[model samples]
Target: MAYRHPDRETIKRILEETDTIAVVGLSDKPDRTSHMVSAAMQAKGYRIVPVNPNADTILGEKCYKSLKDIPFPVDLVNVFRRSEYCADVAREAAEIGAKTLWLQLGIVSEEAAEIAEAAGMNVIMDRCIKVEDSILLPEGKTNR
Candidate 1:
């Protein structure tokens, strides 16, 4: 079978420990998936850094032109781009010493996953962090 990314326990640990997330391809449009997901993460007490080549701001956070432009350490690099673009972003994420590379739902690239894993970074592909977080929340806790 293909490499099953970290087991459930490991994934939970990573999610619990990760505090800051850099959302690549983030857009200012409220209707965009990236925007909505980032907003949800922020609501859950995670610091969200917006990364977009064309945006100046998103969710009140300064929008970085690229992953390399972010001045601080990013615990997680949440990719919101097309599959073809993920490998490049994964390269940058690895170079920047990010702890994890999370490819948003529907955005999957084996090459990207391999690159990040080779760099000793955790990788999650074809999944939505927001949805995962919601699913993992306590029984009565609101995901909103």
Candidate 2:
């Protein structure tokens, strides 16, 4: 079955409600898209947890090797990995009881969406989180 993303209002609500975002594949390199996006989100007051096995820290946040390795709760799992790897991510997100599974711009996987949705996780595919936040909440969401 084809996967459909949530509506604009729901997306806005997700942003408004989300506090901590676990960024999968977040790179330590400043030039990387993942790092840029995560940094933007962090600047917007969202807690960004860098999930990368290769990095000890990024943007001053300790990096976790995997979702399960995160000791705290994750509001959303923002994935920067390739589409082929997202299903595994979705499963890990579910395992960690993440509320949402978001695949970044230009990446989509129906399998990943299915797994996450079945686990009661809100699934957003092929969308940039920072772009959506800037568009939907121009004033920015209050983490308070």
Candidate 3:
């Protein structure tokens, strides 16, 4: 069967519930999209955990080399990596017990979706988390 992303309501709920997001492939450079999105989310009251082997920190948060390296609970695994890398990220997200696997805009992987789904994760592919948050919770996470 074909892959199916969650609806608007579910996406909104996921955004509302998520407190910490582990961002895979996050870049330290401010000009990068990953950095921009993560920064925006952080500004909106979400904890942005940077996952990058190269960076020691991003957006003032400690950066872990990989998802398995994060010592605390991550509510969502927000991937900025390419499509080919997502399946591995899904497994790591599952291993770390995250509730959601979110592949950023223009990135998607059926294998990644399958792996996350099998582990009972809410999968969101080819979508930007920052954009969704802006549209759904326009007021920011002020109520949270």
Task: Assess every candidate by TM-score.
Answer: 0.92, 0.98, 0.97
lDDT per residue (tens digit) for residues 19-109 in model 2: 9999999999999999999999998889999999998999999999999999999999999999999999999999999999999999999
Model 1 residue 75 CA deviation in Å: 0.4
lDDT of 3 by residue, 66-126 (tens): 9999999999999999899999999999999999999999999999999999999999999
lDDT pick, better of 1 and 2: 2
Q: Which pairs clash (backbone N, Cα, C closer than 3 Å) in model 1? A: none
Local distance difference test values of all predictions, in order: 0.87, 0.95, 0.95
Query: What stretches of model 3 exceed 4 Å from their correct place?
Result: 142-144
Clashes of 1: 0
lDDT of 1 by residue, 69-115 (tens): 99999999999899999999999999899999999888888899889
Cα error, residue 77 of model 2, in Å, equals 0.3
Clashes of 3: 0
